[model samples]
Target: MARRGQRQSGATRPAPQRRRPARDADGLLPVLARAVREVESAVERSDVRPSVRTKFQVVALLVREERSRVNADHTSSDAYRAEQLRRLDGIATILAKSAARETTLLGLLAEDAVISEAAASLKREMLIAAGQEPPREEPVSRPTTPADTTVRRVVPQTVVQRQLANPFLAPDFSSAPARPPRPGRLAGWELITPLLRSFEHAAASASKALPEPTTLRTAEGLELMPHQARLIASAAAGHRTFLLADEPGLGKTAQALLAARAVGAYPLLVVVPNVVKTNWAREAGLWTPKRNATVIHGDGETVDGFADIVIVNYEVLDRHVGWLGDLGFRGMVVDEAHFIKNKKSQRSRNVLQLSERIRTRAGRPLLMALTGTPLINDIEDFTAIWEFLGWIDETGPRAELMESLEETDLTPADPGFSAAARARVIDMGIVRRRKVDVAADIPARRIADLPVELDGAIGRSIRDAERELADRLVARYETALATRTSGSTVDGIDHDLVRRVAGWERSDRDSAKTGENVFSLVRRIGRAKAGLAADYAAQLAHSVGKVVFFARHIEVLDAAEELFTERGIRFSSIRGDQSRTTRQKNIDAFVNDPDVSIAVCSLLTAGVGLNLQVASNVVLAELSWTNAEQTQAIDRVHRIGQAEPVTAWRIIAAQTIDTKIADLIDAKAGLAATALDGSDDEVAASADFQLEALVALLTNALSE
Candidate 1:
């Protein structure tokens, strides 16, 4: 970064390069040549930071614009035109070398590489530095297109900067209008309903044949499972629309992110459930580290509009849908696509509208409908998901689907049309892979951490409370040290003193019920996390079936149950508060009922005497005081009778005491057991956890 500044400011630059500069009529060419040379030097040194990358992009853009002007200048002689073109070609060659040296820079030259404001300003500065007037901004002549008039639309400041930098969106000359299909035998046949019926009648496995992957590793060194790589490989082969119905534990988030990168889908829009929105951004950072991703919370006050990826939850789609349509996303991914099965729902409408806008603008944008399971009884929802994929519209099949149906040479009147039609739709990119299908690639039992950011007022209050608690602990430690009776001094923090102080605080809170203690604080965090955890579990239920949801507190369990009921997902609850017979009955219902998607279990009670191998996925909604309790709950599903690999999704609130406790559990209790069944830690009560957490918190405070 410092080198980039030096290169731009010229404070440390050699004077010889500028003193004997070659002359050009307008001087723009020399400026571009000099910048490109600097970029080349940066590339050679492997120091292509954001500023250098922006400089490289601005240089390319200027060279292209200048070349176009030079070609169109009727006043300039052929000799002059030839000379300018040759010089532009020379700069272009350097750009190619710079790109070759730093292959990641090549992505910036792609069509969808967004021109950041910095790059735009750099372009103008270069022109002015070369003794040419900067281009004037044309007034936007378009009239106001009022949309969501009642809804307050938030345009983040960064987004405004980007908009102001590039007022005119790059035109889509790549998409030529599609020729209307030749009228075939299936012409007037009300084909969409039959297409819906075909899926029902031909209820075979809907997984599509995928291309073999050329590489299984991402640029960030994350290796893809074989099944996941197959889908990414298919996307690279130019298959845009996909209904990725991979089961819950199959790393769908990673696959979706990598697939987006495969096609260079920048300014990508991801519509996910509220619970998993933060997880989506985290996965984006892991799989596509070079790209910037932002999550839209509330009215999107904190959103980074300049980010390459925009993640939003379905609940707030109504508020931001208006501007999201105009955000110039080249791709759309609907996670848990079954959420939009009802086209009448506002979420469905917003997603479809956004998909339509992306398709209309991007010509052929990448559209993926991700679900674990299709609504078996509701073909209407499948139609809605297909609509979101742009495979069909209101009246009938879209151009792509219609063309595929035409090639099959069969109508609904034909004998084998159902099977053929379903096959064609599957080929249009329906990829379904279950855990058993890729069991060898993953551990038989695993815990996948789903870090959820608690946003809005509730999130802010919790953080405030945590800080207050920390401050109180810090004051206690300082007071104790200032008036030490033993006269013992330590250079660094006194770990013993911190623990004794934490114990005193915990005992006071338990006795007087005064300030927030670690126990009560944890419960508050649990309540805050309940909705997110439940929402994630709902997604799992929709995608796959038979998930176990375990929460430490009844309030967390109750909150989760309320959410599941609101979402119309069938669930059975097994709690310590329930009668023995009632608990058994609920457990039996969960084990036996196909409609029961989730079994909400108590971490303590359900830890013993249960064989719930029916579920391969577990949702640990709240943290347990002991590792044994949490391990026991997950073991119900990850036990001996389980046929497929199991995944326990641990939901932790990011940037809070919740994260600290989770880390402590993994480190102090035991890290991920991997092939081992359980942790080596003893099963102590919640008091031990409370003491340790407070100790860790106070120690951190004193260190700061």
Candidate 2:
């Protein structure tokens, strides 16, 4: 009897009965419908001027609408419910514009705002549909439909009235002449005095704790060796702070850490090149006292917790400035400060900016830059680096020192310009220590300049290229100058015209221009570089010890590799493409293994922070503009740990642009000390771009 209706219903009904669909208290369909309506209304009102209240109202209403719809249905579809909630979230994000005032909210709004708005809109819609108008709005304000109430949170018309002034943005009510900018030392006395006092206290404690130096002094507690202690003490006391420019294997990192610690500067920040970040961290743990030192990089925890020492690589420092500002870092150790010599580089600019912002509860923080080659073979390199370390002298010996160096000679008992410059610069607190001068265990360096003449055939070809290149360069220069000088009434000449002008120029060199016929000159230089590499390969074959060759051109690198390969010379190259891990591995094999004879590298990749004491020979296939660059390459073998004499051979193509460049580099190297001493004037006069030198080489070759 019971089965009779069931069988009939099965036959007549919509198919056989399947499982009943699941339902929420509020059906998914209603919530989704409500969410869609709110989105539509918000989009229509999107033209309203953006404000915090308007943004908040928009988001809140959307979320409330979603919640109401979800809560109302006894039966709902899962897909419909999920979609409605997602839509409600999106609505909340539009409303979040109200919460963002000072900080950028683009990412936060994109990620989280939408979800919140959807929920609110859904709830608001459901309530309105149930004949429950929210308390805040009057009867007239009530929404026409349940979905309209979902949009009630956002009141576009009353946005201005709802907005409130943030206290942080309020103007300071009290003013007392705003303390007119103070004078030197005194101008910052209020800030500097306390910091100096704190530094003094740290210095005293370090001295008291340090044990007396003896032959076995290094055996004592975590204290520095006597010589190292002296360097640290000097660096810690200076106003200009110190540039610990010690060669590799001389423990530059150790010296910097000890200097900071001796001054009771616990919250010290160290910035190094990317490759050395891990080394610095590990070194800190082994050498420094038991304290929290965090390395900020890749998957590392956010430095929310306090740390005694914070080590970061140059690549990552720009991203974590806020953390640094909050820490009130009292001391900064720029381990490879040379990385910032280019003012345009982010690390250099960022560190300089940080120097401007670093203020403790006590005063402005101290800066310490550590690099072996402060001058890097160029006088301007010193200027670039010294300015970064706060070594400016407006009226003192540093300024007068620059004036004296311009004359280029010295008289008896005059305490020459270089001396005065050193005193003034040193007074500001930039200390430069040389391993050869101070550390005796370090081996002596033997350097030689090898000048070679190209064969007549190649030389003549190179000369022809130079003439063609120079003509084009001059024409290009004149055209550019002409266009720049032309009044705005006339449209400027195009690059093609400039090239034509350069091609037509009669002179082989242009004094006013930096580069000449780039295409021809590049080709000429390329040939010369190849010829020089062949010459270097011939010379290196005779060398006994393992040799490290630093090349500036990839052409030279390839040419040299060919020579090595053809001659069966076992060699390894560490160039830019190799990962840091691979680079280190290759360098280690070259330095440590007797079977491997040579390590070829690019000047840029192996320029700094490398230890190559195992080899006694360094060869530069081409010259760089900066002396420090050459010195760093040379120092790879000449560093403190080398036991044998370090020999450096620079292969120069005589009477070419190579020779001219080498001459300028040599001239600049002589002025590096004075320049570093904070005197730039005389240093500027000694070095000049000599287009005539290039022309003479060209003319001589043409005559040949």
Top candidate (TM-score): 1
TM-score of 1: 0.74
Model 1: CA > 4 A from native: 1-150, 375-377, 485-500, 507-514, 565-569, 669-688, 702-704
For candidate 2, the TM-score is: 0.36
lDDT of 1 at 42: 82
Q: How large is the C-alpha RMSD of every model relative to the true structure?
A: 21.9, 29.9
- Residue-level lDDT of model 2, residues 9-62, one tens digit each, is 443234245332223355433444444444434434432222322333443543
| lDDT (CA) per prediction | 0.80, 0.52
lDDT by residue for model 1 (1-704), tens: 34333444542246445432233466898889889999998876756666787788889988998999999999989999999999999999889767644544655675435565556556656765776655564122232223311223466777778788778977454877555666787788898877878777555678899988988898877888888899999888988889898888788888888888999888899998777888898889888989999998766778987899999887667668877888788899998888776565446777889988888888778898888885345676688888888788788887878989998888899999989998898888888877887889888988889999887677888888888889888888889889999988888988888888988887784532546667777888899999889978887786677899998888899988877765578999998889989988998999999999999998978888899999899999998877777778888987887899989999999988988888777764443453255655444433377788888899888877
